[model samples]
Every structure is written in structure tokens, then in C-alpha cells.
Target chain A: MLNVTEMLEEIKNSPYREIEICAPHTGRVNFAAIQQGSKVEGPHGLWKEKPGTLLCTLDRERNPKPIAAVEKGELCLLHSELEGCFVEAGTRLAVIRHLLTRDEVQAAILKKALHLFTAPERAKYYFVPEIDKKVRTSGSQSVTVKDGMELFIMSRMKREVPLVYTGPAGLIYAVYFTHTSNVDAEQPLIGVCPPDQLAAIQEVIMRVQTEWTEQG
Target chain B: MGKSNKESNVAPAGGLIDVSSHKVLVANRGEIAMRIMRACVKLGVAFTAIFTKEDTASGHVRLAKELGGEKNLYRVSSYHDANELMAVADDAECTAVHPGYGFFAEDFRFARRVSKRDRKLIFIGPSWKIIRELGDKINTKRLARSLNVPTVPGSDRPIYDEMEAERIARTVFDFQVQQGIKRPLVLVKASAGGGGMGIEEVYDIDNFRSVYRRIRNYAMRQFKDEGVLIEQRITDFNHLEVQIVSDRSGKNPVHFGTRNCSIQSTGLQKRLEVAPGFSPDEINYSFDARKVLDDIVHYSLTMARKVGYDNVGTWEWIVTHDGSPFLMEVNTRIQVENGVSARIASVKGEGGVDLLAEQIRIGLGEPLGYNQQDIAFNGVGIEYRLIAEDPDNRFTPWAGLIERFGWQEKPWLTMHTHVPTDVPYEIPTEFDPNLALAIVWGENIEQAKDRGRLFLDSLELKGCKKTGGELKSNVAFLRQKTAGILQF
Candidate 1:
């Protein structure tokens, strides 16, 4: 069902997500039961044979606690010196990488529109789908809109609010919201074509991320 | 006045422990980092630089590597991340850390962490205790008043309610009337704010509540501290500051003369010149120009000595049109315009003491070699902050790839910037407005002003195609101000 080239392209574009495990307090590391590149599922997996597991015990003077895996991923100990040495609170102990094999795309309404669409129960809006009647459709199931095209119209109290789609033009594969159902901010209103067609959306997200990074 | 070897081991209340043998870590970026690196090179001390991801190709990083080898360059996610900075310092085996202004320079927690015994690192500035005390405007004003330093009359305490603000405004107005002052104005300032940020002027009593609320919100958003203080705004005033350096030996602090930064637009400093701009024959208050200079130097030293402040710090004051001076705030770190003082002090045959190097020596538990009388001010020095912003667009900050850049070097002109010209370089849009600084010194203010204009005309900034327009500078605005045409 998935193209091999498209799958590889998705893997290349997806950013590597890593979760770091830190020391709870200033203390010595009692033991590290897992090795580098070990698969860790969860905390309970440390005691049993499970797919994802990571565990390390730190010996504080009053309390000895176990630090376990928070997500299912391969464990990579960042500091080997922590085995018998003291570490201050907030020191990184290990990092886990969540490897992905397939591509998945998600579309959501911008959370910034909450002030206009929500909060008032009497608020009402509709998505006036920008379907080109002139263009010949490949089939009845295919519904595609260009980037910056009007995806929907949101109105509150008889006043129309402008809303446009900012992602790459592609086929509308799925719709998550009903015709008259209430939509929450940032809710996945619809599912567009994944992989290559989401490039515009990705660019917008990167720009926003850059802005936030600069602010920090 | 230098410290003996026997007293070097003991750390005073606000003094730096001996760290001469230690490697220094500069936890900053840009021109300030390069300035610190230069100081380290002069002292023959090995130094490391921590740069953000955005600064990997920056000139400061390259300079650090060239000075102390490639191993000395460390990269972090951001300059404000204390954890990463400490980790890098520890990895590099740095014994002392110099936080160039803006990031962790005033962060007391960072200072505490650096000075902790377990960390085994020394902060090359005042102690965390002193920074915390002087950082709060209310506490600083109180301390100044206690030390017989004249401070602006305002709400003696922090005002949380509108009633208190109104009452303080009325009291200040009545006092101004009694003092026979005209056009009394009130200012609401953030207690923990600096750099002329979070300051609002109140012209009328009717809009006091709204202005106060707006200032509080701005302060809360900018500094995360909503605490506000009210003070009488000096309308026709000259912004002057004295740079002072102290050591742990409890000896007298040295004053590096005074700088007049009156050429400011919208509260942002545009140009700063030494020698105060006014001659002794021009205006006479209670004291002549010489007496005023002497009084300022004396007050600055006395305050530093009282607080046991070590290393370089600045005391800012507002000299009213009527010639009365009032303490405004204390900057506990080296300033961007410190080159003006350095240049002025370096004039004549007197050995010019590098303020950054002096900071390092003080951090090494070395007493100031010279006292107040030994220091002399000669010639006039002026500095212009070259910011990458469009003046035509209300000073909106701009960022783009600088395709071409060049500046002519002159004997009287000194430019401090980290523009990467060898390779393609783009200034990050998210940082401060300042791209570089053009500093010039001459035998007199006129020569200095001439050299400043020449220096500005020699520089150029070209943007890439994607940038849409040429990179902008405030040179024209600065020239107008220097020529005495532009006035507030």
C-alpha cells in the first residue's frame, strides 16, 4: 500500500525525536542495568523481557530510586562516568530515540483562531470548500485544493470570518469534522494527501519554529 | 595598591578568589565575546568560548579557536542556557567564566552556580549577593540614598495600587513646586528592568491608571517582574555615567572619568562621547565643570567601596539642565560603550588599562594597581552603535545575508564587530538590533566627531537577493545627532 521511494523520502524528512532521562536529584548512580543501543519499552519492561526497556538506579544517601524508560525506544547512555560518580539534579543520564519506518501526515486548524470560533456557545461557522468546478475531477472521491485557497468559512453570530488553507495543494483524502459539528482549536479538521504534498505546511511550521527560537 | 601574595588566597565578601592559573570560559557571543577573548590573549590566559548553534560560523567562535585552538570552541543550543554553558565549561576544564553583558551577566542564579565550590569556577564580575541587591531599582535607590548619593525623588517604595501611585505623583509634584522646578513629569519604571526597557512617562494625572497598567504589563512581559517604581522624569537632562573598577583589597576604587550619552532617540542610546560636551565657561550650577566631574568621580568610587564591588561596573546618572545630578541606576557589568573610556584613558603617555583585562585580573584576586589619582582622562572619544535596522521603517530589525562588507581602518577609528566576510554570512534576525560599534578617539571632541563621520561613510552593508533590500544602518541618524541638528 506504500511506495518504497515515498517511504524513504518520509523517513529522510522526519526529524529524529529523542527523549532524555535526567537525574531526579544530586546523588550517585547505583547501577545501570541496560547497555547502549538496548531497546526499552517502559518502566515495567526493566524487570521483564520486553521490547522497550531502560533502567538505572541512583543511590541518594536517604533514598535509592530507579530511573526507567519513559517511551519505547533504543537507549543511549549519554554519560558513562555517572556509573559510580555523583551527578547534580537535571544532569542528563541517557537519551532514547524513537525510530520511524513509515510516513504519516496530520492537518489541524490553527490554535490562534480559538478566540473567534470558540468560547461562545452560539458561535457558528462553515467550511466553504474551494472546489474548482471547471477542472475535471479524476474521480468522485478526489477533492483537492490549491495552497492559500479558501478551505473553509468560519462565521460567528452572523459575521463571516476569513480562513484559508496554507499548505501545499493536494487531494483531501479524509474529513474528520461533520458538516454541522463543533470544531475545537487545533483539532484535526481534515486529512490531506501526505508525504510530498505537505511541503508547504512543513515550511510554515519551520518558520514558526524559527521565530520561537529567536524569541528564546 | 596591588595585593600581596599572602592576601591572595582569602576571598573577600564580594571579591574574586585567586584564579590566575585557571582557564577562562566566555559564556557569550558576538563582539563582546571577541572583546573578552582579546583581553584573555593580552593576559596570556587560555580561554574557551561557548556559542549557540546560530553562532557556529560567527567571528567570535573563529577568534576563540585561533587564540586557544579549536578545542576551545564549544557549541550550545542557546547562550541563555546555563546548564549547557556549565557543562561545556566543565568539559573544557575552565576555572573562571566571563558572562559578557545581556545573557547571564545579571542572572544571580548563574553567578551562584559558577561560584559554587563544587563547580570550581569563578564568575568574573560582582558577587551574586551584590548583583541581586543592586539589580532591584528600589533597593539600589535606597542604598544610594543611604550613601548620601542624590537619587530622583519618587515613590519611596514599590507602588502596587493606583491610590499609592497618585499619592506619590502628588507628593513629587508638590516637592518639585517647592524646589521651583518647571514642567514636572512622572515616570513609571520596572524595578528589575534595565537597558531603558519597560519605562513609561506620565504627562497627566487623568491617564495615570492606564499608563501604570500598561507599564506593569510591559514590565511583566519583558522582565517577568511586575514590580513598578515611580520617579520624577527629568525632561531636559544629560545622561552621564562613570566607569569604576574595584578590587578585593578594600582599597580605593578607580574612576575612568565620565561619558555623556545625551544623544539618544526614543530612549535608545545612539551615540556616546566622553568629556561631557559642555565647557566650564558655558554653565555654572553650584559647582563648575571641574567640581562636577570631581564630585561624580568621588561619589562613584565611594559607592563601589561601600558595596565592596569588585571588577568593572558603571554608575549611570541624570545631570539635569540646571546642573544637579541624580543617580539613575547601576550596571554591574562592562558596557558596550566602555571602549570610549578605554580610548580616553589610553590617551597621552599614561599606560592604558584595558577594562576587560582589569576585570580578569580582579577575578584573579589581584588588586587594582592604580588608585583614583593615578588615572587621568585625556582627549575625547565617541562611539556609535551600528544597528541592522531600517530607520525609515520605524527602526524595524532586519536580517539577511550580507553579500559585501568592508571598512577602512584609521588610526583614530576602532570598529568592534563580528561580521563574517570570508565566507557567506547572514545576521540572525532574532538577536539584538546592534550589528557592530564604530568607536573613534581624537585630541578633541570636534576631531572625534569628524572621525566618526568618516568612519560611518567608509562602511557598507549589502544584502542578498532574498533579503529584498540593502542592509540598513543608523549612520545618517547618528551623523545628524553628532552634528547637533537632531534634538529631542
Candidate 2:
């Protein structure tokens, strides 16, 4: 069996990442201007427009409306049945990978604190460290964490339960919550980073947050 | 100072009501919210509306702003969150909350919360205690039995386990044998379910176990209640209901005639018409159509009074081919078909006493203002629900921007829709697909049918155009049903 420290280290070192393009509204896909494995710039490429440029059209009557790109990245995994297909709003249209160096990617992840656990609403949360903080950070510059491990607790009504971590294993970059206290749902309670997999982890976190905001 | 006679008649349970200064928060959406807003306008009361993020640009939000001003319109995340809705009501300083239909309209917890809130907001529908009593089918049937109201033959208690289900099925089979029913049918239903959901039909004894499990699973998923009830399924039956309005005093409950909604597809009501003797085929089924209707009205009022029901409600019943009416269930809120019934009632010279307005009046501890004898059942009205679905594509829901919505002007027809013209409207991906309803009233059923056909043909919703044509409405189905050429 792998020790808790080793498991956390393994999670922090692993790297796997992808970005998805989602449909802005519900309609029939008129056409797809770009194919998979196409390198594109922010807003413009095969579709030929700037950021917020209409990549394709969705027909809802005799009039066809535009579906625009929100960011600039290399296109990948274009849906096979894209043309003449009905797609609901918020459905993932394609995946994209941002072309960046290792140092630039790490800077991007740290700048936004994209690795933090943002509270969904205002509530009291209790932190429960899985491993001794001293042992996990003795030789490292950050705290390590693993997926499926409980690190915090939230009390709702009369029940007290642990708050689960759904993201991949990562290192705790910053600790914003020093005690069990009430915080706004929009506030980020902690900052985390996968030491060697910042790009992959950031991609997952961004996609999840995007979907969450859209649903709200 | 001397006390007035009207003041003496006020019920002690409700205390003295001051409707003149009351502010109501409408906790619903779509056409129902508009209906309630009209009532608030007529009564000279402040109205409030709560909407979600999806409905920020909806017509209901605009209507609420127009009626109650900007402060009265609130945008919440979810309609099902009772605490948030109550908080909005409190912030708005509403005197009462009117749950138009669906959502929390029949939720006993919401009613209790409103009544128990710090500010003590009044609920426009029935009291929470009464809602709890009638919401449970088992208790409703028991109360109906005690009041001598006819109910369908079924198990007296809820079936708990597999053994209990089998036992009830055996008993139903024996009852069918006694009634000389060769092709016996058993209906398994959730004790706390409504809206034609969580129901299953069992044809054979061997299939009882699987069907029961399936229905129980569905009930648990949908209503969070696994308790099931068994009832006999009437193969040939006519769907009918009586519209009744009562006050908190419970002494006077008046029925406003009967409505026939026998035409349905996949358990959803497609078309509804007021009065029974309109169609020759329908009249042929019953020995005396007038007497049957009278019986329905009488029984419905009787049960309403027994339950001490308040506000507007519909006592639904299923009339078998033998002309025996069995109490199916009770809808504690205003239904979609009420538009047609209200139109017919207005034509009867009732001075257009809107049902929603009457419900608010009753909530204010006022009487129904009129008695059963004063109601005049005149003219025929038919309503067709135009759903945003494809009939050719197995009725798949289609959502998109409505570019062109065209409907000709007609005095006889009244369209109840939230879709705005002049500007493009986007039908969201979530919620029910019911886009609008078209209600047409005439001197008689024949005239109403003719006008309905014409109105439907003129109406158009140019959403995402399919390969063959535009998105299909229920126009074809409504036309065929009106002509009596479509089979139910």
C-alpha cells in the first residue's frame, strides 16, 4: 500500500489536461469551419475572426445565428456529427489546448489562484488535515493533497460531515482558512497546485467552474 | 357604536381581514403569474413576482415590474427552494403569497412555512393543515368515503412491501371476478403523487411484482415516497371535473358547473371543453347528460365542504361507460384548463368574476360573493395547449429563438402565451415545453369548434425549421379532435 505522503506526491507530479468549447445556446449546427488538430490563435483561425469571433452558425428558423469563441487556443476533438446536429446550450462543442511554456503555464495557474476551493455560498466550514502538516511540508515548499481525501468539514442544519475534494491530487499552495468559520460562498478558502501538472489541473478546474456558473 | 351584520358573520378562525391594504407575492411563473397579476390589479392590491436567472428577460418579469414596480420583482436561483422564496416574500413585505400553480402551490411545507414565518404571510390557497390532509391520496379517499363521496374501488391502505402488493393484487383480481370483469386491470399509483405522474397499469397477475417494483422505484425517485396504492382501471371512461370555490368559513362552497376533458393523449390533456352534452357521441354514452353533470357538481361541492377546502380547487372524477362517477383526485390549485372554464363563466353573465381574483378575495377572508344559484352556465368554450414539440420526431422537445410568430386578430379567440412579439424570444432548454394555450368561446360547441380550427390554422411559431417543415404544434391534433375524426 502507498503511504499517504507518497500518494499525495504522486498526484501532484502527474499531468493530464484538455480544454472544451461549449455551445452558447440551443439550436441546430449549421456548419463547422475548423477540423480537429488545427492550430488556432485567440478568437481567429480557420473560422477567421477575433476573440468573440463567430466560429459557426446555428439555425433556428430561416435565420442562422452565430456561435462565437470565448478564448484563443489550438482546436482538438471536434464533434464528429457537428454539421446539421441539434445541440443544447452549454454542451461541449470541441476541446482546445492552450500553447504555453512550462513556466508561463505555472505563472498563469498561480496568478488566478485557479487551484483554490471557492465556497459555493456563505457557510461555516471546518478543516480536517489528512496528514500531519509538518511532515507533508518538511522538505517541500507547499502542502500536498490527494483526490477523494477529506480535508474540510461543513455543518448544515444539525449534521456535521467532511467536505470532499473532487479535483485531482495537488499541493496546497496557500491556506486561506486557518479556523472553522463562516465564509462567503464566493470566497476562495484555499489555494492548491499540482507541482508538475498545473496545466492539466487548471483546465479541469476552469471547465468545472464554467459549467457551475452557467447552470446558476 | 353598533357592529355591522357582515362583521358578525366573519369566521373566528380567520379573524378580521383587511383586503384593501393587503400586498400579495405571486410565487409562480408564466401565464399563471399573469392571471394572478390581473387579479391583483382589479383588487387594487400590490403584487410581487419572484423569477430565476433563466427568466430575467421573461414576460412575467416585465409584467411584475409594470404592476408592482421594480422592488417587487426578485430574481432567485431556484423556484423549489422554499426558504429563499419565503425570504424574498419577507424582504418584499408581502401580506400574503399566492402560489398560482405547480411548484409550491400544493406543497404543505411551503404553506406551513409561510404561515409560520416571522411576519406571518398568509397563503392564498387552502390552509397547510387542509393541504396535508388532502395531498395524501389514502387520507383523501378515507375522508371522501366518510362523507359518502363515491371513490374508485381500491386497497384501503398503502401497500408496503412485495407481499402486501401481491395481496392487494389478489384482492383486486377477486373483486374483478365478482364484477364479471374478464380482462381485469389494476392500476398502481403513488399515494402522494399528482399531475398524471407515477402511475402504472398491471394487466396480469404474473407481472404484478415487476410492475410494482418499477412503479415504487419511480415514485421514490419522483415524489420521494415509495408507498403505493392500488385501484381498478376503468378501460372506457370519460374525464370530468367540477370547478368549486370556497371561503375560510367553510360554510359556503359553490360549484360552477362541470367540464369534460375526455380527449387526452399519453395521459396529457390535449383539449378541454365546458359542459358535457356538446358532442353527440359523448351524449350517447350517458343516459341523461344533464343529470349526470348535476350529480358530479353535487358530489364535488359536498366533498369540498366536508374537507373544509378554501380558495379555488377542482374535484376531478372519471365517469365509466356505465355512467358511474368515481372521485379520481383533487387539484388544489388553478389548472391550465381554467382559462376555458373562466371564459364560459364570463359568457354566462357572471360579470367576468375571474377565478384568481375570487381566490385572492377568499384568502382575504371574504365570501365567494355569489352562490351556486346565481351562476349561469351559458355558451361553449374549448382550449388547446400549444406545446413546443415535434410530432413527427416522436414528440421531442425543440427549443430555440422564435423568429416569426403570426396570429390573426379574432374577437372569439383569446391566446394565453408569454412569447413576446416584435422582439425575438428564446424558448429555454429547461422546464415544461408548453409554449401557450389558445382558448376560443362561442354561442355553442359547433361554433366554438369552427372558430378553434380557424384560429389554430392562422397561428404560427417559426422556431428551428425541420427538414420537412417548421416545428410542429398541436394544431393538427386539435383540429382533428374538434372534428371528432381523431381517435383518443
Best-performing candidate as measured by lDDT: 2
Error of 2 at A187 (Å): 27
Residue B143, candidate 2: alpha-carbon lDDT: 86
Quick one: best DockQ, which candidate? 1
Give the per-residue lDDT digits (tens) of candidate 2, residues B1-488. 01113552354454655575788988888888888887888777787887775666677888888888887777664677675566566666788999888889888898998898667988999988878887666677888888888898888777778898888888887899899998999998776666655677889989999989877865764567898988888887778888888887777888766778877655444444554323443335345555667788888888788878887888888877777788887888777787677777742354464778778878867665556766776677787877766555534455556677769878877777767766777665445556777778877767877888888888876775312345656567667778752112
Residues B1-488 of candidate 1 have per-residue lDDT tens digits of 12224443344443544544678889888999999998887766788887665566678988888888877876565676676677667767888899989889988788887887476788988888878777666788889889899988887666777788778877877777787877667888877666766677877777778888877755664567787888888887777888888875646677777887787656454444554434454334454556666677678788888888777888888877556788888888888888878877842246455778878878666666555666776777788887766666655455567677678888887778887766767775336546677777777656777877887777776665242556676778777767651112
TM per model?
Answer: 0.71, 0.67
**Candidate 1: segments with Cα more than 4 A from true spot:** A1-104, A108-216, B1-20, B157-183, B275-287, B464-467, B485-488
All candidates: DockQ: 0.05, 0.03
For each candidate, how many residue pairs have backbone atoms clashing (under 3 Å)? 4, 7
The docking category that best describes candidate 1 is incorrect
Superposing every Cα of model 2 onto the true structure, what RMSD results? 16.9
Report how far residue A55 has shifted in candidate 2, in Å: 38
Q: What residue pairs are clashing in model 1?
A: A40-A52, A40-A53, A41-A52, A41-A53
Error of 1 at B231 (Å): 2.0
